[model samples]
Target: MLPNQSFVWTGATPGVRYRFAILADAGNFLPDQCSTRWGSTDFGSRGLPGSPGFSGVPTRNNANGINVSWNDYNASYGVQHWRLYRSASAANRCSDTHIATLPRSTRSFLDSSAAFNTDYYYTFIASDLNGVNGPCSSNSAAGFRPGQAPTVSAISVSPATVVAAGTTVNLGVSATGAIPSNTVAYQWRAAGQVVGGSSPSYSFVGQGNHGTKQYDVLVSHPESAFSVTRSQNITVCRADQIVSNNACVCPGTLQEIGGQCACPPPLVRVDNQCLAPTPTPTATPLPNSFPQIINQPQSQSVQEGQSVTFGVVAAGNPVPNYQWFRDNLNPVGGNDPQYSFVAALSDNGARFKVRVSNSVGSVDSNEVILTVQSAPRPLRPVLECVMANNDGTLTAFFGYENQNIAAVTIPAGTNSGGDANLVNGGSILPGTQQPIDFSPGRVRGAFGVVFSAQGSAAYTLGYRGTGIVTETANSQSTPCAPIEPRLACVNPEGAGFRARFTYSNQNAFNVIIPSGPNNRFSPAPEYRDQPINFLAALGQSDHFEVVSSSGGDLTWILANLSATASGNSTPCSLPPVCNAGGPYRVQQGQNQVTLNASGSFDPEGLPLIYAWSTTCPGASIAGTLSPLATLNLVGNRQTCAVNLA
Candidate 1:
């Protein structure tokens, strides 16, 4: 039994406290499987019945039934099923029973059967198949035995100024009453005539009604004598005045649209007057020159998993090619404004500076030191059953975010929900669509999307609101999540050290490494930080980053002390040697002489590339430095040439 009304033990919605799962015979075992213990949101509550709606005001609708309201946040996502709890008396409020079972998306209820002078309390919870019972808050509303009529605070109008013909203005009324807001009706009057509007606001267009008009709004209730009236007046032009707009005839130039004056093409409005358009300036090409650094790199301290971006503003003759140096030594690649990546511990103390080079000489930027703090230990990836949002493909879905509470948690085990599987560190590319199914509910739906090619990539969660649901938006899942953005950050160290990041000036969010470096270090080795893919390096340069472009500077702090490297490089070996020829004999040539020079050797047995040259001017040699060579003599006496080193 719930606090309000007894929850009928029905077949479809049977469990008081239920257990649900989606584990298969294969993917995940029971021990590792995740299951959620869910709760519900509170329904509407009525305070003491005899109390007046407003403290000092008497409600004329004391005979009317009570009106109850609650938030419909779950319906916006995927959760639509709702259970309403009602208590007959204040004493029973904490022990209300589930009195009503509402379908998905139901938001409000009216209890005309509620007895007058009886204080009733209401609470509610929403759920789909895969989801657990929503949060059930115990809040305490009351229908009055109608007393005095409702009160009219004020009725007013915007723009009391005189209006041109056919101009629309707004009329608004404020009211307070014991009568439920939903039961109130509004009647707007214009010049003592009735208009067709039931809302608190009315749009009244003035079409020159003899220079002046009167308007009033009446607030009324159905079950009570509660009522109020207020009135206001406005001046309207008898007719719209014609304005001249010829460019040659008018001062400057003007055009008219919908009884308003506008400057024509080639003319623009300046202050209250129209004037000739200002000429736009064309940009001139900048001359090429050597690289000069404008904005230098700055030092940072940050938690691991966060990304950092090292940027530089430079001027150069040719667009400069950027080379980022680590420890003022190793080279990272780029020519753009920034470099970004996840931060690793190895990046700590790793100094970063950029050297921009073009046709002109290169200039190095100031080195920024990196400090990495230990990342907060990561909570296990959590999956949960949730009401579907319009961005999903199915009616029901298991959530994929990292929330730990019953409202947002994951299922334990190899529970497959449509397109969602238990893949570690899964990837969703830009523009790629994935399928999601709410488990237990097993509702199938999909959201096919092409992610944007630019900007950092991320996965975000929605707390609750008018999100997508399977029943309402069964097949049409919106690919867009609300712009609750995530960060892309990194540590300067290669990896292994945990890192985290969040904007200091904004609401805090979970720290995430959206991606590795946008571009890696050049002679910089590939970086791996996860435990298994580790590799030991002697003297290598690499890049790790934390995103700084998203409005904040990245700071990496040294939270834990790890080992630092000392000696690097192997001992030098013997250099290779080369000999010209081994016992070469040249034949006395009739027209030419052939020399045998096949034997050239190196002490280190290194493969040698051969080059041959001669100081003799008249004699010609064929295939110089070849195993065999033929020399032709132009003169009777010529010097023989044979050289190799």
Candidate 2:
């Protein structure tokens, strides 16, 4: 504060008066033809000049956070610093404390320190090199909120019904809008007692002695106080019957296992009974005949490093013994049901034949050819998902699923020597399944991975960051939230004012109102011309905050703040309080000043008029009873007295 520092003189001090006289004579007395006239004039239209804006359109617009960017204010007025302010409502322009104090060197901020489902208002203030604080750039930016809690749904159980007593069942759950802090717990209940716990599935034995037992699987989401239960009954099988197959048998007719009657070893059993033995084939003598091939071996097409098999089926009176031949001539191994070999490149186009010999005669079957193809290379890895972190970064998860003649599964990337080739800008090394975190800012890059058995793949990626500021007013005094990077509004101040903070950046700023249902500041935080509105409300008290979106210092002038009543058109149970031009902190200027009542609103939303009175010399109110009026200043040294009813 240098003496007579003009740069620091943003406006005149309130309630302080100054007089300057341009007299005809430097040493004239009041009786002579020399005089000095002075009066106060309030001048300047509503709204600060020039709109602030984000540098680009927002890429990430979720409630978590919003990224902001803008050009510096005009430098002509010796502007040297800019400050950012936020509140739940936009009404506290005169008293709102800024959350950040940034030098002219940069005009960007990543407002990641936001709470879920909370709306915030962000505005910037510029100051001259001498530390004179300027007015709002525009109104504070409209309210924006952080991401919300997870919504869990789609719960289910596998193998829904029970067949055996000791069967293991699996319980699964899926959720949407999930956050990183969510946890899940599984509990299995039986006989109204905790029988088993933990994990996604529960396994228990059915007790026949207890007859049918009803078991319960409980899935819990304790964070949101939400839980789901699924119930199933397991019946105990009697010794003479099996529930799995509904089988009933007489004593000594079958084996018994786990209180259920069933077949013996090496026999397929169903419904408490053993499968009947296959009827012994009856052999009949027949006349001698040449062996015939009823079913011929088919040609084989196999890739390199793979194996192929061929077989022939024949009908003969005396049955048949078979011998397989390769290339239609060379004899191969044992006489079995089929001939098999691990195919090599040299085996391509090779033909094979089978010879059948019966007690009556023998015959040679037609040759079958073998074709070889090239083996497939490793498939490329694919990016599975990405999540935005509060610290201005992204986490990318990658994996690979191969699609071939047969459904094949491939690993995310090649682990040739411990390191993977995917470049996701994460801290995790390649070949690891854990997601990688991308740093704050725009996400745009390509990542690749080479699979040893599957082909290689490269992917382009992108993600946006969210930045913002805001506050909420309780009908009463309540401490601010996001306790880390905030100055919360308490019950006393701006409790019911319609406050909105609006701003623009080089890209794109927050939407005054988000497009969907959830991104709302639901505790009734209001916005008007961008600054948060703090109308006088029932049981209201005085409140103030000293915090930042990330960093800044603010000096709150508590005495200058006053809340006026304004609400909807609905009738008010209490008397309506008159609002005079929404409050004030005007600087002295050469031209007259205009008062704007645009900031005022009825608590019951009643339309309002204004009334003005002034006693400044050579000054008059443009309209004595109007929301908008002017106080004309006739002299350079006078103060206009203003009072409203």
Question: Model 2 reaches what TM-score against the true structure?
Answer: 0.25
In candidate 2, stretches whose alpha carbon ends up further than 4 angstroms from where it belongs are 1-61, 66-71, 75-81, 94-99, 103-110, 127-132, 136-138, 146-170, 174-177, 180-645
In model 2, state the lDDT of residue 10: 42
Instruction: Give the Å shift of residue 67 in candidate 1.
Output: 40
lDDT minimum window of 10 residues, candidate 2: 504-513
Clashing residue pairs in all predictions, respectively, total 111, 92
TM-score of each: 0.25, 0.25
**Top-lDDT candidate index:** 2
Ten consecutive residues with minimal summed lDDT in candidate 1?
A: 46-55
lDDT of candidate 1 vs native?
A: 0.46
Task: Assess each prediction's global lDDT (C-alpha) against the native.
Answer: 0.46, 0.48
